[model samples]
Target: MRRSLIGGVLLAIALYLGAGTLLFAFQRSLLYFPQPRAIGGPDRLLMLPVTDQQIAVTVRPLASSKALIYFGGNAEDVSRSLPDFAEAFPDHALYLLHYRGFGDSTGRPTEAAILHDALKLFDKVSALHSEVAVVGRSLGSGVAIHLASQRRVARLVLVTPYNSILELAQRQFPIFPVRWMLQDKYESWRYVPAIAVPTLLIVAERDEVIPRWSSEKLFAQFRSGVARREVIVGAGHNDIGGRPEYLSLIRSGI
Candidate 1:
C-alpha cells in the first residue's frame, strides 16, 4: 500500500511539472503571432503625419463618398481584405491598417502603440474624406472601441470581440494568475460607454475562440442610443469578413 501511494505521488508531480513547462513555452503563440514579411498588393503606402510608421492605405478611388477604416484580427494581414472592402464600398474610400508587427510595418504591436496608431490614422483619413467610419474584428475591436471613444467616427462596427484581454486570459487559464502576468490589456468594454457614435456589434454564433457572452457583455455596456444592432449569426472569428451579412451591415451604414 505504501509503494502504491509513493508511485501515485511521483506521477502527480511529474504531470504538474510537465503541464507548467508546456504552458510557459507556448505562451507567446497564445498571445500573438509576430510575422514581419512584406505582403504586397495593389495599394499605395501613405505615411501618417508626425510618425515614422507608414500605413499601407488602399483606396478604391471613388468620385464622392465616405471613408471606412478597418482594424485587422490579431493574426491577420489586414491588407488582404483591402480588395473586398474596396469592392464593397467602391464609392467609399477604404483603408486597412497593418498593425506594427504585421506585414511590412515597423515597430512592435502593443496595446498603447496600436491605440496611438489608430488615432494617427483617424486624423489622416479625416483629412481626405468628410465622413469616416471604423470597423474592427476580434482583437481589432479593442482598437475600434478606443478610436470611437476619442475620434469623431460617424459609425463603428465590432465583430467577434472580447471585453478585455485580461478577461479572455482568465477564461483560458483559469488557474494561472493572468491578471498580473498579461501585458496587453485590450479593454474595449471599458471604452464602449464613452462612445456616442452609431455602433454595430457583430458576433459569431459558432466562435471557437471568443465566447459569445463577451460580445453580449460589451453591448450591454454601451450607453449610446444612436442605432445599435447585434448580429448573431454565421462565420467564425477569423472568417467574419467573408460573410454576406457582414458586407450588408457595412453597406447599411454607408
Candidate 2:
C-alpha cells in the first residue's frame, strides 16, 4: 500500500508539470488577435511614430469640442475598424491605437508594454488635442480605464468590459493557477473607482466572451455623477458595436 501511494504521488506531480508546461506554451492564444487595416482603404493606413515604436493609427476629423481615441479588444487590429469609426465621428479627430505587437506596431505584446505604449500614445494625442474622450472595447477597456484614472479625459466609454482580467482568468481556468501564471494582469477594477470623467459602460445582455455580471460588478463601483450604464439587448460581444441602438447610445452618451 505504501508503494502504491508513492506511485500515485509521482504520477500526480508529472501531470501537474505537464499541464503547467502546456499552459505556458499557449499563453499567447489566451490573448485576442485581430488583423490590422488602414483607414479609408488598405493603402492608406498611417503609421504614427513614437519614441520606442511606430503605431498604426487611423485618423479622421470630426466637428466636436472633444477628440475621440479608441482602443480595441485583445488581439483586435484597431485599424480594421477605422473607416466606420471615422464615419461615426467625422468632425472630431479620431485616433485608434494599435497595441504593441499589433498592426504595424513594434515590440512583443505584454501587460507593461501595452500600458507603456498607451501612455505614449495618450501623451501624443494630448499634446495636439485639448479635449480627448477615450473609448475601450473588451480588452482595451482595461487600457482605457487605466488611462482615465491617471489623465484628465473628457469622457470614457467601455464596451463589454469586465471588473478585472484576473477574475475572468479564474473563472475560465478554475483548476489552474491562472492569476499567478498570467503575465498581463490588466487590473481595471482597482483603478475604475478613481476615474473622475464622465464614464459610460455599454454591456451586452448576451455577451458570450464577458458575462454581464462581471460588467455590472465594475459598473457598481462607479459612484460619480457622470457615470452611466446601458445594456444592448440581443447583442453579443463582437456584434454589439454594429447595432444601430448601440451607436445611438454612444452618440448620446458622448
Candidate 3:
C-alpha cells in the first residue's frame, strides 16, 4: 500500500510538470486569436513598413490636424469599427491597427512587438496631426496604456481593461505557475501612473471575461483625477461595443 501511494505521488508530479511544459510551449496560440479583416480596400488600407513585416492599418484619411489611433482585442478585426468611428468623429482622421498576426499584417503577435508597432504608428500619426487620441479595447488596452505612458497622447480610452494578463491567467490556471510561463504579461497598472493625458475607462457591467475587480484595480492605479471609470449597465464583455452609449462615451473621452 505504501508503494502504491508513492507511485501515485510520483505520477502526479510528472503530470504537473508535463502540463506546465505544454502550457509554456503553446501559450501565444492560446492568447491571440488572429482574425481576418472584414473591411478593406486599397483606398482604406495603409501598409506600414515595420522591421521586415508590413503592418496593415485600416484608415479613413482626412485633411485634419486631429486624429484617432485604435488598438483592438486579441481576437478582434479592428477594421469593423471604422464605419461607426467615421460617423461619430467626422472631423478626425482614423487609423485602426491590425496586430502583427491579425488582419493583413505579417508576423506573430507578442507583447513587445505590439508595443513597438504601436509606438511607430503613433509617431507616424503625430507627425501629420497636431492632436492625436488613442483608444484600446480588451488586450489592446495594455498596448494603449503602454503607448500613452511613453508618448504624448492628447486623450486616451480603454475598454474592458485589466490590471494584468498575468493576474487573469493565474485565476484561470490556478494549478500552474502562470507568472513564470506567461510571456505577454500585459501589466497595464505598471504604466498607469505615468499617463498624464485625460483618460476614460469603459467597463461592461457584466464582463464575463475580465473580472470587475481587475478593471477597478487598474482604474485605482491612475494618478488621482487622471482617469474616470464608466460602467455600462447590462453589458457583457463582448457585447459592450454594441451598447448605445459605447461610442458616445468614447466621443466624450476624446
Best by lDDT: 3
Cα lDDT tens digits, model 1, 18-75, are 7766766666567667554343444445545436665444444454558888887888
Candidate 2: 10-residue stretch with minimal lDDT: 36-45
Query: How do the residues 137-250 of candidate 2 rate in per-residue lDDT, one tens digit apiece?
Result: 999999999999888888999999999888888888888888788877788888977888889999999999999999999998887685899999899999887898876777
C-alpha RMSD (angstroms) for model 1 = 3.3
For residues 120-208, write the lDDT of model 3, one tens digit per residue. Answer: 99999999999999999999999999999999999999999999999999999999988888999999999999999999999999999
Error of 3 at 55 (Å): 0.6
Report how far off residue 227 is in candidate 2 (Å). 1.2
lDDT, each prediction: 0.76, 0.81, 0.96
Per-candidate TM-score against the hidden true structure: 0.83, 0.91, 0.99
> What is every candidate's alpha-carbon RMSD to the true fold?
3.3, 2.2, 0.7
TM-score ranking, best first: 3, 2, 1
| Ten-residue region with minimum lDDT total, candidate 1 | 36-45
Candidates 2 and 3 compared by lDDT, better number: 3
Error of 1 at 184 (Å): 0.4
